[model samples]
Target: MPASAFDDLDSYIALPRVEALALSPDGRRAVLTVAALRKDATGYERSLWEVPADGSGGPRRLTRSAKGEAGAAFTAGGDVLFVSARPDGDDAPEAGQLWLLPAAGGEARPVTRLAGGVSSLAAVAEASASVIVSADLLPAATTLEDEAVLRKKRKDKKVSAILHDAYPVRHWDHDLGPADPHLLALDLSALDDTIAAAVADEAAEDAEATMDASTPYPSSLPRPRDLTPAPRRSADVEGAALTPDGATLFAGMRRSLPRGSRSILVAIDVASGERAVLFDEDGVDFGEPVVSHDGQTLAFVRRDRGSAERPFDAAVWVCALDGSGARRVAADWDRWPTQLVFDADDTALIATADQDGRGPVFRLPLDGAPVLQLTDDHYAYSHVGVDRARGGYVALRSSWVESPHPVRIDADGAVTPLATPAPVPSTTAKLTEVETEASDGTRIRGWLVLPEGADAATPAPLLLWIHGGPFASWNAWSWRWAPLLAAARGYAVLLPDPGLSTGYGLEFVARGWNAWGREPYTDLMAIADAVVARDDIDADKTAAMGGSFGGYMANWVAGHTDRFRAIVTHASLWALDQFGPTTDDSEFWSRIFTAEGMASHSPHHSVAEIRTPMLVIHGDKDYRVPIGEGLRLWSELAEHHADDDGRLPHRFLYFPDENHWILSPQHTVIWYQTVFAFLDEHVHGREFVRPELLG
Candidate 1:
């Protein structure tokens, strides 16, 4: 790839991306899930690739099919297991099924044939060769055969309606339907016996009968036993961990409340299918369970669901397998762990958490010692897998300047980049830090991405970009909201983590709790002030933009100030009062604000004060910040600014098929095109070039 790959949207979109990493139990091999643009350039197809865990050899593709493969894991015997929708034989189901590739090198075979298919790998036992996978099943299906019959009947009748007995009928991007997720256990150790018996019966009739029975063999792995039976909608498993012996499964299950839900940790006996509550508390939720190497203890995160007054901090808690001797570890640690896994010796936990403006790995000792920072770099780590036998870790790390790639982290905190098939694209943009003191004496910090030639003589135009999650921090590399693309267009992008952004401790988030318009807005203005004052930034040519919570802030900025020449808000909350009842999870937000408090911070009330030209973007399928908010914002903009003929200076870009994030490759290209075009017209004083694909 050329060095200017980031300059062209086509080349940028075609770049291969690494997503997930999995390590073998022996700590010798690592596998990654890499997604590349399809031939049609409409979407991404995921495939598994093998990379050396010891950082010795080049990456090699492991599996290939038109349907592709993902969710890779390793069995105790070193075989690779993945989920794919590829057709197996004449009777193969259309949904995704588990497939296994031998470690000794041979053809891959289907391990499952369930009609509903596997959703994700829940847990894998290192010693027992037992596997647990999550799958969706219809409410009435009592067995795998019954599930297949029910699915076929539904397809034959073309029935698409779903009856809802719960509060949330829709999730972030998809509808929660007649089929809910359930955990299924498969004993891989017993697979050989089942196949042998089937072959014996066939040989009894014909002495020369060959065992060529298709991809799924005459006998696939014995029908998976349903561990979570008739769980309805409450079987929402947040995280799961299996003992090394595969005798017990600790899972975080959601307990549905009258309006909302809370997660609680539970332990299930894998043999008898008996369950017991491990931990449960009011106003608190537990998740991210990880078992010790010896299976004697469990460590999980306990989160307090704060009320309308203050924000809560997430703390790490450890307990015995029987739910006794529960205690919080590293109680003074202010940062929140994004991912957790027991260290090789089981004396500590290897975790990644946001600190300052970067996400780095840390080691938390169970003895209550101070947390030790592991990776002292700018990269954020995820999909961490421990090499228990060898005493190291394998994880995928990325920064603002680099895409996610696998790396080996030694026990002494040294990071070695592993060979990856998806090479990191080169960019000319430079990254730097910027900070300022807020009005309340709090420090506000952010990242400033500058173009190559930006200097005192040639200042680059600025785009103030806010992040979503209101609770999340701008600490990691995001392919969807990359600032490097903006830098390629000769623009500087400001990524500010104002109030309510994590990693700054609970007090920083609490400062903006229930007061989104006060501290967060001012903090953003403070950082913007400090950045614009620099000699390398164009103070006059500036714009503001954000999505989700950041979009809400953009709308707030537009309503309150006219400093920026233009504004862009995507999937933002407009009328908080109307948004309360219409959102997907009304209960969560409702708990954070009173009716009066919501109306006070609402941006729709101040729409008449807006004077800058604005561009509003939304997707019809966005459930978090629904399209109704966008329509309302657009309608109000027209109502307040339209002339006699009902025309206005604002524009609305709507996507009918997209969700909260513009996921489609083609759609992402169009999104950037429209955004830059709008900024060109208002901020750069150039003619707007409409995206050709829109026509």
Candidate 2:
């Protein structure tokens, strides 16, 4: 029997992530927006696809585009309503106009004109009576970028350099502006051979992509003409739900002030121009508030937005239509409750959870333990679609071990595969799992993959594989980059789920919080030790490499110990403290790490103590860990190299147009080739491949 095999360095380790899923209320049809492959050398082109509820039927192509096709929903008249990025006209990142198509396949019709991009939409009902749409850049979403635009217009010889230094982003990445979004309710009251609708007075920023937070209605629409005025200020109005009775609209709230969360719900009378705050709280926070089908209950996800480590362990909750009998259904559950839907009978709740490496589906009652296992195999199971007629269950899934695809889980729990635009290749490289303990007696689960032809006792040069998502797991199969590429290079690679990796439960992930540089670092060191102890591995020839969280850890490893001869860090975090103010989550470190913790954990603060030769890579537009981390580390190490011995060697590889994750196929191949050459130089005692530079 073949042991669970592993890859040297597979691209599957860092592939694209699928974000949204929608099933037609009828069940026989489902639509979803799969994330584009990171590289997209061709440019962003994500679209809507159709699948049968049974999972045995082929996936029918519904929508395709060059820029992107996201935010899909089913119209009341049994048609597909989606957003697609138009080409040639504008390169607006958020410019997708709303379009409608019959589920059985017919010409797609443009529902309305969009000044920007459509971010999301809410169907009035499966009957196709009316609809609510959201597009950022619609008037309501147009933010005042006057200052920012003016600054750009004023040219300076040192402008590019200055912008680069201030933003820590590659100049090539998409220019982000003060994004705006709007939500508009459409009146499809006409659906025969034609479609008719009115845009609410202003658009809603329901989709955070544009940062607008009000509903969009054209002047022609009745609701927006009188009293239901558009919102003027920024508010957290993310996530919306349709009441079964179809009379009222609901939205959740988020705040950036004294708390990241607030107990606020926006209740709009869909018919009248009147609206009211369903509820507001100072201590309790609300998010993902969903209006149930019966129209009597409002289901939502709630958590306390505080500095506490477990600020958002959201549980499923419900409230009466009249705002009475409020109670939580599954709040204390450890997993991050994602994609919620009431089952066909409304007797059970199906939720997507990151309990394991793959996003798995779990079924829970209004009050009880969730069914342990619902669907397994494939990358993950989420984006649930429920329709009582088609047995009412569907999911969109993808994983590090497998490409993103759709699957159907029956009432009997048998998962049948569905179709996807980009099907996972039929073949798999190989995978295996081995468990080892770290220095602190904590157990570590690691995988070892061999070159295609080489195996036991082959004495292959070793590539130490690592993963980001410090709170997430480093599992096997379909992740892109790192391991996939390493494996292709014909080296032995090993990946370990260090102490704080997810799927192991709550305590495991929480351990990574303030202990950033400690437990995780220790877990990595122990992997090298395990490899050195094995006879099949050559201790004299070994390389350390990783990206993002893994990259940061690799830097720390090389700086702290010389057990490995070569190191490469990509989109990596060097200074954890500097990460907050410049990153999307500017306040994260302030909450997770205090001044002392930041100083104690940052790799930049400790790099002078490193002895290993290194290669640093960063994308110009990466706002996550940002490019500054990579630049600073490389410059300091190089500067000190000139002053110290000739022993230390290091290089910096910057992707001009890339973000935290290198997406272009050309850049990806070039990156892999460069790092492999670097590893060859030190581990094999010679640069085996000439490094090719991309212009």
- Candidate models: Cα lDDT each: 0.89, 0.62
| Candidate 1 clashing pairs, residues 3+ apart or interchain | none
Q: Write the per-residue lDDT of candidate 1 for residues 1-695, one digit (tens) a residue.
A: 44677788888899899989999989999999999999999999999999989989899999998899999999988999999999976667889998899999988888887887889888998677888999999988666666777888899999999999878888887888889889888888766535566576355424423543222223435568888888876567879989989999999998989887899999999888899998889998899899998888899999998888778668999999999999998989998889998988889998898888888888999988889998888788898889887877899998888899999998788999999999888888998989999987999999999999999999999999999999998878898998899999999999999999998899999878898998999999999999999999999999999999999999999999999999999999999988888899998899888676788899999999999999999999998888899999999999899999999999999999999999999999999999999999999999999999999
Which ranges in model 1 have alpha carbons more than 4 Å from their true place?
1-3, 193-218
Cα displacement (Å) at residue 327, model 1: 0.4
Model 1 poorest 10 in a row by lDDT: 208-217
Clashes of 2: 70
lDDT of 2 by residue, 221-328 (tens): 223111123332123256766665556667664443432324467676666735677667665566676655555667777655444344234566777766678777
TM-score of 1: 0.96
